[model samples]
Target: MTDSNAALNAFFKDFAQNLGRLQKGADVIAGIRDSDVDVGSTPKRLIQRRDKVELFRYEPEVEQRIDTPVLIVYGLIGRYTMADLQPDRSLVRSLLAKGLDLWLIDWGQPGRNERWLTIDDYVDDYIDEAVERICRETGHEKITLLGICEGGVFTTCYTALHKERVRNLVLTITPVDFHADVDDPAAHHGFLNVWTRSLAPEDIDRMVDALGVIPGEFMSSIFSLMTPMRSLTKYNVDLVDIIDDKDKMMNFLRMEKWLADRPDHPGAAGRQWLRELYQENRLFEGKFELSGRVVDLGEIDVPVLNIFALDDHIIPPTCSKALAAKVGSSDYTEIPLPGGHVGLFVSSKSQGALTKSIADWLQARDG
Candidate 1:
């Protein structure tokens, strides 16, 4: 016979244990971006806040700083903070500490005005507009554009749509080619295509109409199903570990905070992207048209650096490798890392080597 008190104690004990885990911050899980943190008396240079994207520009103090200005384009599907996730495990921080001048685009939470915004709005209106702004402000003719994941697709389209404007392009863990099988074997396998497509415009409209913003958890669940084990098992492990870590707990909370955020994907824009990019694979074949211009891969005349993760389940090698043949630029090169899709930017194992390689490659071409 088991003691009733011991069983009840166990249930209540875990609740207390959960409280302890909530406080320890580990693995640099804190979501504070270095740029946003105002360290007392720290010299600040150029930081421009845009209506859509926040620009964080860090000036280099090293002698003879590189001439080419680097602009980072993070994925829009998630928060841009992943690049600067941890204090030690950040791409932007690492780049800045190395004396590289940088400007990052933080596409702010989309509002009602931005509803129905499409890839065209991202590539043509915002990115193109940002490129011109950066060029004019920095007194540079061209920019070294770096894009990741869906952001990479946006960048590639920008390169194709506006061939002459970009100097050098760097794609990190980008899904340049998504027509083939997904990198992950367990992903939804087009379940989203069917479900999202089957969703009537009114269905989408009813939700967004009822709710001012699209629920973040709803969007996250869609992505989380890609790796069922990740959602099921990862949380269990965290429950045990986070029992005593408030900071870690907060860090977890922050990531959860970011994960729960789901700004509405404009109804019209979402339909086009889901149908064209994912459904029909129009980007590679030059069939995609936006704002009266065709997105031809052959128009990518600038030098390009494509980085794909060998072990990434989200964007397999095939997804990015198609860039080798699709581009018109002779200066195309590809680097495949051992990290996963998001690990290319956030994980500790890849940060040092990957960031160095990126900077070195850009420097070689720009020089």
Candidate 2:
């Protein structure tokens, strides 16, 4: 055989390999079902419900190692399901395996009727009530409060107001100093802070009043703008890259499902989050108010553990690190983990470290 026969064979071999990959990809896509991509599948029982909020206690995965119960408080902007997005990648599962008595508060989707709900209501009323209920149910005077993102702000405010009810406060990817983003060196990090500041207070107020509730789609669009290239290529480039691997494709789909489930932010709360905190930098200055009471960060004297993602573009490290100087806790700890905002909980590398750190910290202070 000469060069002509060898060239022909090589061309056919390449064509056959490409055809096999395409067939496998097609089969994988065809087999995927709605349930295959379902997120937040960890088993949990509903403990109580109040208005749009519901409290849930996860069934124990192991014997409770610590006496103090742990309540996970996620922000209203996104669903609490994110903490338990999947069986293996779930923060809820990781902590439970460490013998934590984990409970979560779900701020159910708010409609137009909830437009009047403000930050004061979330911090002073709803959260306070949840804390009392947890105390009563667990027979523990004080429970550990683990707040994430905006929920961290709510928990911080609550701890400042009623420090006795909290034993340990764990904040994850929480921004204490909204304006601290200005100091962030990364171009991508703190776009939300800058964007929020670009708007006038009246502009935010007017948008909230006109819409009644901030639409989830609108918020999603703003987030997409922060990472425009990734958002644009997610379906095409990202999905295509993972299309041949079942596990990788499933992970991508589950994340997309979670992102699609964003809930509307209540109007009054949205207004305050944008104007009072992001715009005015009120929380860091101790000028933020809830129920006629100022939220003085210096008053949070509980054992506080602040965790922030080092590469978090959404909530810059500078924004979260600022909490250390303001809090009055004699026992304070800071954990800087690798990954971005969502990756802190979902990334395999970070989630294990995150949960273990929380468990160890809580156990040390459990007494």
lDDT of 2 at 46: 92
Please report the candidate that would top TM-score against the real structure: 2
Candidate 1 structure, TM-score to reference:
0.79
Which residue pairs clash in candidate 2? 40-85
lDDT of each: 0.70, 0.90
Give per-residue lDDT, candidate 2, residue 133.
Answer: 89
lDDT of 1: 0.70
> Which portions of model 2 miss their true places by more than 4 Å?
1-16
Candidate 1 residue lDDT tens string, 1-367 = 4799889989899988665545443333455453443211122354666566666665554643457888888755676677766666777777766566677776777766766677788889888877888888889888888898778888888888786778898998775555655444546343443455455656665765655445545777877886678788767786557645555554565455555654555444555655677666778767888887998888898999998887776667777888888898999898888777767776678878788888788778765
Residue 111 Cα positional deviation in candidate 2, in Å, after optimal superposition: 1.1
Per residue, candidate 2 scores C-alpha lDDT tens digits across 29-68 of 9999998897888899998999989888889989989989
Clashes of each: 18, 1
